[model samples]
Target: MRGLRKYLTPFAPDQSGAVSVLYELGGIIVICDAGGCTGNVCGFDEPRWFERKSAVFSAGLRDMDAILGRDDRLVAKLVDAADKIDANFAAIVGTPVPAVIGTDYQALKRMCEKKTDLPILAIDTDGMELYDKGEEKSVSCIIYCICKGKI
Candidate 1:
């Protein structure tokens, strides 16, 4: 008999949902995970992936990166990408790697702010939850960021 799988597909997780809402918002959306999560979101989770263009990217987290909790590298990559591209805003979507490693998103946001003047937002999706939860958190964060003049 086929063994049971711990992870299921057929739907995007919270991280993907967070990215989806910000897809058309003229922002550089970064998914903080390995490439597989990005592929799933782009290939399956996101319906407009083929119809439109977005600046969604994967952080390309490696074993060392996750184990050491290297937020600096992630910040550097985001900064470089942001400098190379023109975006009205920037969003950092979290995933299992970051969640498992306890990455500091608030600090990352501050670091990104120091490097770039563009408005920045972060969705703290841990990948263990569903899509709607991510969407809700992201949307609320966007509003909060705007209200606090962080965006």
Candidate 2:
């Protein structure tokens, strides 16, 4: 994905860019939303979805989950997915739901770090930003992974 960007959608937001970089990283990229963001990434944004598979998932946050700020439930879900899937690392891709609820990515990262063996990445990208911004944070995550020898 370095020096190459291909997005079929007309307006690819940060969520799209995050999934783009994460798609090639071989780790689980969990979209921290109910469903819309994950749908956009798998349905159209990242063209690679149709060609290959990646560990992309939705938190399946219900209305009360977001309203009640249920970070524990999210951590449990992430840990469960980690235990079930074979992945190099795990990334929590932010979306409108967590962004609106003011989810503390650091806390979530720490929480996941305790229960899981894989490295955790927290990309706090709101749906409001552009694709480049998402790529920026995701690329930084790549660097982090590389530095930690997880890549």
Candidate 3:
């Protein structure tokens, strides 16, 4: 798997461009992930985009938490982080590790919404799934869920 820095670092050079585009469009921006080494990297490019929109949050799932079904910790962390950033909504993106362990994302979603009164989107992007496959699945799910009024 690629290192988080590898994916996130390059975006620093392009931050201005990405932020400008997202700002013009307007909306919350979030990158969900388990607390994997690489998952954070996937999000490196997002902070700038998020900062521009003035809304962003991350929910980091720990390894032990994933195996033990301790999604509450993740939920708490997410809530705290969301509050710190004052995010309007949050996005939940999965990493390879959580997918393998079968984390109960649905429950986490419910908890986050109940606690924060903010919209939560749970995206399944298990690492074992091919890159494109995961991306497509996550995007499709988000679209379908939105159109169905599930989000």
Clashing pairs in 2: none
Stretches of candidate 3 off by over 4 Å are 1-34, 37-40, 43-60, 149-151
Instruction: For each candidate in the order shown, give its overall lDDT on alpha carbons.
Output: 0.87, 0.88, 0.53
Ranking by TM-score: 1, 2, 3
Global lDDT of model 2 = 0.88
lDDT of 2 by residue, 9-98 (tens): 337889888889889878888899999889998998888889999989999999998999888999999899998998889999998778
Error of 1 at 95 (Å): 0.6
> RMSD of model 2, in Å?
7.5
**Deviation in angstroms for 119 in model 2?**
0.5
Arrange candidates by lDDT, highest first: which order? Answer: 2, 1, 3
Model 2 / residue 56 / CA error / Å: 0.4
Q: Which of the two, 1 or 2, has more TM-score?
A: 1
- Please give each candidate's TM-score: 0.91, 0.88, 0.60
Give, for candidate 1, the lowest lDDT window spanning 10 residues.
4-13
lDDT of 1 by residue, 16-103 (tens): 7898889998899999888888998999889899999899999999999889878889889999998899999888888888887898
